[model samples]
Target: MDHPASSRAGVIVSAPGRRASLRLSYANAAAWGLGNGLVSSTLVIYLGLELGAKNTALAAALILSAPQFLGLLRFSAPALIDRLADRKTFCVGCYAASALLLLLLPWAAAPGRLATPERSLVAMVAIWSLYHLLEYLGTVTLWSWLADLVPGRIRGAFIGHRERWLLVGTIVGMVATGIGTYLWRSHIENSATWNPGDRWLGYAAYALLGALAMLAATIPLMRMATVTTTASRPADHVRRRLAELLAPLGDARYWHLLLFGCTIAFFNGLTQSIQFLYPAAVLGLSLFAMLTLRSTMRLGQIAISPTMGRLADRFGNRPVMIACQAIVATGPAFYLLATSQAPWFVAGAWLAWIAYAGLNVCLPNLMIKLATPHLRAAYIAAYFAITGLTYGLATVVGGWLVDTFRDERFYAFGTTQIWGIYDLMFFLGWIGRTGSVVLLFMVIEPGAKPLSQLLRGEPQDATK
Candidate 1:
């Protein structure tokens, strides 16, 4: 004898429930960002310097490819969540798994314990792959779970608020990691009591602490389950659920959006291959300087997210996306110009961050908007899978290109010069991204206002 209200779809109708959910969401995002920031900035430094992975291309390929490759498995999440019939349990499991996997990563890279150098590298990659797989799983499930909780009309404001707090966590985490690493390095260098050969022990210690923080962050998410609705509807049969996975591919509109997303992912993978190496290898910047530069980028995101969100709500996600693509197209060229100077690279990071923040906010919102409520999870999965496969391969290709021309340099007119490997990458990436901007015009969001109306700053009164 279920009540009619209880049989209806799960939606938070009361102000108190929504407020409680929002608070928990903010707390979870901040804690998760803090954990990520602490370890993310350290990965490249620890691998390339501490582990003596001097083959830049190999290191970059391994680091960037893991996530993209594993992201394809996101297709399984929706079906799995349906079968399990509990998004909260699945998400918490992922969070716990990520913490354990991250803590276990350092052990795989332990220098002398391995039989050979090659074996150590292999072990590191395998461990990191597991860690990234869990990370993506957690992200995919969490997004779907949270999307169900948010009321449609207020989604823009809520996402903006969450992103702001997330950036704050990231800023604080970056500063702590940077300053902490610098001091640790200094202590090891100066202390007669410390062994130089054991410097990697410091990375392991920090990773353990970060892992603990990741687990601690789940407290908020767990508490939120009691106050919020984590399930959308009942599960379907395996065959029926499997058939629904193809629905996104069948829908012309969803297909176009997926293509648009995949295009961006391809170009991003190209640039991400060198994101860490270009600054570190070319400019010889230290960990502290790199993290400081990243913190500046986060500061920009924090400042711009609110405006971007409101604009998306007012105009449309399509226009915001177009503007973001235009800005993103300029990023690689900016990096090309940064060949010899730290300030040039800093400027590039700032510009890229601002553009990326807008895209980050709008793209997901648009995807959710386009998707039918029952199939939203599957739609998100399809988007990630298509993009992930293409992006993963592109990343490996970028790595190969860099390795081919690492020692080669091209001299220009008079005293002007360029590092051959990175220069080619930046220039080519610029061309690809610039060309991709045209695809946005082809995407038709049915609910979005016309481009002319958006340009005129007219609100779409029709948008629900």
Candidate 2:
């Protein structure tokens, strides 16, 4: 039996035990990433498009955004974690349950008496939403659990190392799935003996394999040391509990971080659906081709994640975050340049997105660093809730704009043809993203040097 701890502030395990836990954590990240890549947005969008659900922008938007919208459920996680008091059990149970739901996805899209194309699309969205809800809760608990397991001084390096493994797993899974799907489609198209509907069988195979990988991810958690919560009391009053849940709002520095995060999330989501639709619908990119692009992005992430993490540790997360955010904001310009005639321009967009690796590593490190140890879960949950809701709302609104102006076109000087709804949304996304950088300046990270000083290799001030 595992011993119970009073608080989850620092490394609670022995050095040997900590080493073992880190190894298991790396394994968990790998398996989880494999599962994630197998059931990625590329596959979901492809499945929806195959079901004839892309006739409207709203459907595609929901297919991509609805599951993320369920991130609002993260707010419930702190209370649930407190009630359960066993982060590992809550995380493992949620992951296992979510993985099981993947089995239903292929059937949800398969033709049947009860399933029309429209109905199948709705079912797919419903299933994914529930899956994400469970997964999101598990993620909250897992992060809170990890905060105690890893030391703060080397947190950046640890996250970077784990991120590299995660990317490796994702790249392998995506490439394999892409190759499998490509060959399967090729066979169905050429062979007279195969039923075209048999293509759904391929999806079933992917779902089963992905589910197994996700289940495998939980096994590592079972081996790791358990971190028990002591912050909440069983006899605490309802009103007091409510106040505790809302406590993060009283933190001014965390509030600034929240503002920056939400702003960035909204802009990033504003053109989320179009990112997939334009490549597939307008440019006629194949599933394999799209997956290849994603793999390339992951490869870039793998290359830079460790370096970015070290830079964050050396120069502070804020400076690295500011630089990466600026680079990522330019991504939409590449999308704007891509036409059916020159679809390769989209490759630049993916390349520009490689900078997101830095932001991903730094953002969470900062969040974990900022939160009070006991109330860490609540702080994380609040960040996810506000940012996620903003993102979902932006996606839905952007989709509505696309649907509302599907046929409309505009021009700057009435001679040069500005594209339709897509161009407009992409331009707005660029503007929103670029403008949001100002907010990052307001985010206070003590001892964090300015980007200028970091670039100049200046030493940190004695007082910071």
Candidate 3:
């Protein structure tokens, strides 16, 4: 691979020193966690516990899954960035715009009430969709920029270290939000006529803080190195650019990778709509308990990130990713077995995060490795775009499924009655997630060792 600063045309974009680049990357990653954790971590819980949305599943589909429906915009960002040739500016602008948009959530609720009427919910969805659209544009550029700043030789460590920073920020953010919500809930638990809209005030405050964090993170983003090579620049010919955009559709390997990604996205979307709902509505977990459950998962990711990164570096992303899927496949079965408020359920949830650490570290790197340098943005765009469309539809369908079976149950295991719809969906998700492993082998990385060699503990060169 070419050096971080130089491109195929032998042009040298002014580069930040390695230490500075890593520092900036770390800061940016932390900022992302802090800002996102505040809004996204407890969004579904807030909807039910605070906002009192009529249908939590549908609300989640609209607010959380709405981003995926905008995936085509992400696919086009690379070409847009190519023409602009100024990734840093675009990324910083996105951070600013998202920060401003987040303040509108509280307003999405009905006047003086915590509930989001359908009209307000639609407006909220539109705002969130716009926010995510900008975020996607920034992400395409940011990943491309990072790929340029960090050399291929140490990319694994770089991504691993970056994830570590992200975890730290996420943990802190979650804790802060958790504590704030907990105290607020305690004061109002017994109050008569305590308007649910009151909680939106607190969330609005939290969201503002998150928005500021995003702005703060942009400072470091602005300081990062800029790539301005002729090679990095997009083709001026509109016809040529259009042709390149559709070129990935013809590559067998790209299709294989895309298929694997879509499988994961579909199941993830299918389960994500109800991850909080199952615990709250089915398991009857309190807010504190939910916090503990989520914390366990995040903590597991933190502990295993460095090790997973090293494994990916020593072996290859493909093998590590396959192992991750296998580990995650068994997680849903544990949830199925949780019949009460037992410690085992928490323990079961933690198992999935152990696998998530590996997946989180490997998948992005794999996307980068799968594409040529100049075409990296285009490939990433396509990968996200395809997965986005699949997940977007899945989330809505999953939400509808939940409402359909909210009061239904069927006898299973000879006397135990399971929530018929959710249980069935969980089993299907397990199958889909596990089945995705089959397609991983079909993806060919240029310098990666074969799966057979990897399992035999043989080291293969990955110095592409």
lDDT of 1 by residue, 1-464 (tens): 21222211354335555467679989988987787777773454455356665576657776777667877888888878766747778888888888887877678667876886567766776767777777777777777776767666667767777888788887887788778877887899899887776777766666667777788888888877432443454355776687768878888888777777888788878877687777777766667777887888888888988788887777777888888888878878878777554446546745575777788788777777877766777877888778988888888888887887788888643456545878778778888888888989888775777778777878754244
List the candidates ranked by TM-score, beginning with the highest. Answer: 2, 3, 1
State the lDDT of candidate 3 residue by residue for 7-122, as single tens digits. 53333454445458679889988998887767664553454345455777777766657878886788777667656747778778877787777667656643434333556667
Please identify which of the two predictions, 2 or 3, would achieve the higher lDDT against the true structure: 2
Query: TM-scores of the models, in the given order?
Result: 0.91, 0.93, 0.91
RMSD of each: 3.5, 3.1, 2.9
Model 1: CA > 4 A from native: 1-14, 41-45, 192-195, 226-236, 340-346, 409-419, 461-464
Check candidate 1 and list the clashing pairs.
Answer: none
Each model's C-alpha lDDT? 0.74, 0.81, 0.73
Candidate 3 deviant stretches above 4 angstroms: 1-16, 110-116, 190-197, 230-236, 340-347, 411-419
| lDDT of model number 1 | 0.74
Pick by lDDT: which candidate is best?
A: 2
Better of 1 and 2 by lDDT: 2
Candidate 2 residue lDDT tens string, 308-328 = 988878878887788888888
